[model samples]
Target: MAWSHYREMIVWQKAMDLTDEVYHLARSLPKEELYALSDQMRRAAVSIPSNIAEGYGRQTDREFRQFLSVARGSVFEVETQLEICIRQNYLSVPDAKTALALCDEVGRMLTTLSRH
Candidate 1:
């Protein structure tokens, strides 16, 4: 289907949701992590949707696919960071379920999009 805007895409919308959740999660981290793990998580989370929007705006199909790949990688990065937080006792598993689910969803969507 042809989408007029990136916002109209379900994947993009989900990614934005993921970003929001990650930001909230980051806020729960210790003050020492404000410039460390927290910032890294925020940046990776933000990259997912940002890359999607940027790719959607690109002129060429290859460029769009490239950006989607970047976004996909960011999804994995965020997932790893989430795991790190969990292991570090910064966040509990129950508190991270939603964001992790979103990460999985976004990663799958990006993979599907990049294939076409």
Candidate 2:
């Protein structure tokens, strides 16, 4: 189906869900990480959907593809940070699993969206 708005795009919707999951996971981190890992995770999480929305608003497919690339990068960033959180003992294995699953879903969606 044709997407008339960024909100209508499944990629964007999944990105938003990933962001929320990341945020929830971040809330369990140590307060000492407020300006470090936690902040980085939040920013990367927000970037995914933000870039998708921005790209959708742009005038051309090339520009949209560029933005999707940026969004994809942010997805990686979030995934990396989640791994770091697990390794650092900042987040539990189960929590990390949930967030990582969402990240994987968003990454797949972004990949498919960017190709077309």
Candidate 3:
């Protein structure tokens, strides 16, 4: 199957899972953070899949690859924010660990796709 059709794509599936986890995590943040970290995390989470879907729908390998690059950047952005969250004591060690691992997986997937 093509890169666009990796049904068992751990990255895509993990991205989806990460989005859900972010939503759940955001719920625990202080209400004042609603427009801050919570909002940023949600947007970053959404960007991952949005980029993938937009790229896949572009109907050209170059366009798809370009969007994948965007998605990869978002993954890094999220990872960095996650570290900040840890430093701020906003997220527990386990939560940060899991989120970072998922982001790493997405990064690896994007890199593999780029090489194709």
Candidate 4:
């Protein structure tokens, strides 16, 4: 499929799912975290799919790679935040594990896309 068509691909769909998971996870945080950890998590989560969609719209391989890089960075950011949450007792270990796994998968996908 063309890149535009692939823009609607299932992996991208999965990434969106992961993003939603992150959003929900962050929303469950205590009110005290609303503008701090919660907000940062939400933005980091949203950045993954947003970068992918934005890059796909650019229609250039290099640009797509650049945005994917941004997306990958966001994944790392989310993972770090999740770790902090777990350490601070904001998130359960299991929840943090799941979120980290999702971030890892997305990171792998972004790397694969960059190399291709």
- Across residues 1-28, which tens digit of lDDT does each residue of candidate 4 receive? 2545645755577678778888889888
Best by lDDT: 1
Q: Write the per-residue lDDT of candidate 3 for residues 16-69, one digit (tens) a residue.
A: 887887788778777888999989988998899888877777868899889889
List, in order, the clash count of every candidate structure.
0, 0, 0, 0
Report how far off residue 62 is in candidate 2 (Å).
0.2
- Residue 18 lDDT in candidate 4: 79
* Candidate 3, superposed: residue stretches over 4 Å from native: 1-8
- Best prediction by TM-score: 1
| Candidate 2 structure quality by residue, lDDT tens digits, 8-114 | 88888888888889888888899999999999999999999999999999999999999999999999999999999989988878878878998899888889988
The model with the greater lDDT, 1 or 3, is 1
Pairs that collide in candidate 2 are none
Q: Judge candidate 4 against the unseen true structure and give its global Cα lDDT, from 0 to 1.
A: 0.84
TM-score of each: 0.98, 0.96, 0.89, 0.91
In candidate 3, what residue range of length 10 has the lowest lDDT sum? 1-10
* RMSD values, in order shown: 0.8, 1.1, 1.8, 1.5
TM-score, cand. 2: 0.96
Cα lDDT listed for each candidate = 0.96, 0.90, 0.82, 0.84
Residue 71 in model 1: shift from native, Å? 0.2
